[model samples]
Target: MPNLKIEESNSLISKAVIMTGEAPSAEAVPVSTTRTGQMMWKDTFYAGEPDIEAVFDVDTEAIQLYQSQASIKYGSIAAGYSVLYAAFLAMGLYGIASVCLVIAFVFGVLTRLTCKRATAAFNTGGIHMAITSSCVRYDQEKPMVSTAIAVQDITTCTVEQRELKPYCGLFGTNKTINLIHLRVANGSSSKRYVGVKDPRNFARLVMTIKNRPRSAAPPVASSEIVFR
Candidate 1:
């Protein structure tokens, strides 16, 4: 019998494996970072999700500011009435003091309700935001408000640092807060995400993922012909 030799084509087999596995690599996988923040009623005030893919906690300062503002607004109104009631009581006007007390009680109840609403907005910490390829979603328990907005719908995303002066710069220290403003396309309305750490980086990451070009199908491998 004539001598014969058989050889395996390793190159061809390896190439086939590489091609099939290469498709996943062609698709750009999103990178995500977790952020923590306090939840405001406005933050989790919306509903519905656009298929969430990632989640980030609301910034702590944002939630704190929101609660503080709510407290101030309702507290001040309640306090004003309370002061009036105290004054009337001190003047020994029984009938007028009774009326003022009723008024103060009403205002105090309203303030308490407002604070409860704020608390119900989220749990102890803050709201958790879900980030998808196209939109971002804000959700929380208790109040059950979830909001989703597409990236393309976003017209403007800005980070602003504002100095907060207490007592009109009289005797208190000033603080700065970072706020992220996102405006909807072709609309005058905008949403603000505040106290986000490294707001610029977060904004850039969102925009980069949003603007990234959609990947096309992977190319099929072709064999080259060789002759000796």
Candidate 2:
């Protein structure tokens, strides 16, 4: 399969990366207008009817839109090692040259592998969320993006409006755009951004339900959901 990097990352398979500064903007949509859950609010991305209590919506920014940060760094490492290996081989240092070659190969593999699984979710690409009492489920459109968030893992959720030219340029305007920062208890570096119609209210909604205990709903399979 051809390895694909989401513009920011370097991909050996891709000769050049074309960047267009297009801010991803979409109006927040209701999961179900006719069928409302007591606690769960689901988009078409989720399957199975558990009457899962759906709550407020979260317009998510996919990790696939961000994780290319490491691609060029790894590619540079591989290239540096390959150059050192060539120099060593030319100087009759076969043992060291072989080791350098091995290191180069390892880094090369990592450069390729980093293009996949940028987020915890499986190829997710939706901007809206299917919310529950304790978790926020996202829709998947492309691969390597996040799919869900456990509310218990969250320590605090806050929105910071800033004017910036982000790496992906997925969401930002000439004026300050709302960037909701969801800090976790474990302090994991991996984070997903979200764009919503009203960021302050969205952040408030997340905090209000952040402490609710998760439901004992049956897990939904990816293949089972119908992607809209």
Candidate 3:
């Protein structure tokens, strides 16, 4: 087997796996990274195998890499209100004590209301997979579709898993699947976490790489979309 070099970026945060098997006669095409953050929601893991696989072909099929939702945070609204309260308190020192208290109370109420609204508005959905760089080897007909995402777009590649014990402890009592968060940056240096089916093992494999940086990558076309 030829030592195939899978290079996405020269950064130290990208992931590449060079397995023994070659791509099934063709490289799969890339698909759109849906910005919509909605996913199939259920209380517990579905009573089935966790769907996880590499895209041999995407255009003709669907590959369920990992299903996780983005976190819907509402603390922003409450935090915003708290800022207003602080402002009111500053004014209180200027001989406007009663007015400051009233403003604080009003702002606190507004913040609470805003938080409630956030619970409905702020929600996390879907996994962030580097679809363009994730690929397999194949025939020349199936050229890999390159995404517009430049090397700067990715922060790191991560592998996730369903841990029996939560790292934070006492919060997630039940064992659940989680993505090994990869920090990928776009333009403003914001970090994003990506979830893989088996993160622990993936991380180990990544660390095994003698010299490499974590960064962006993804996959596929004409094929069977199977969810593990």
- State which candidate has the highest lDDT: 1
Off by over 4 Å in 3: 1-130, 133-148, 151-172, 176-190, 200-228
* Alpha-carbon TM-score of each model against the true structure: 0.49, 0.44, 0.29
In order, candidate lDDTs are 0.52, 0.48, 0.31
lDDT of 1 by residue, 1-228 (tens): 232222212122111111111122332232222332111122322235444433343555445555556566667877887788788889898788788778777777877755654575446544555556677665656566567788657745666766654442344566666666777777777787656544544454355445544469342222111111
Write out the backbone clash pairs for model 1.
36-58, 36-59, 37-58, 37-59, 37-60, 38-59, 38-60, 46-146, 47-146
Residue 215 C-alpha lDDT in model 2: 59
lDDT accuracy of residue 113 in candidate 3: 45
lDDT of 2 by residue, 1-228 (tens): 232211111111111111112232353223332221212223344446453334333333333333344555677899999999999999999999999999999988887755553443233433445445556565545442445677556655555554433464445443334455666668875344544334443443444454333359432211110001
Candidate No. with top TM-score = 1
Report clashes for each candidate as comma-separated counts: 9, 11, 39
Residues forming the 10-long window of minimal summed lDDT in candidate 2: 219-228
Candidate 2's C-alpha runs over 4 A off are: 1-28, 31-43, 47-65, 68-70, 89-110, 113-129, 138-147, 158-181, 186-190, 193-202, 212-228
Candidate 3 TM-score to native: 0.29
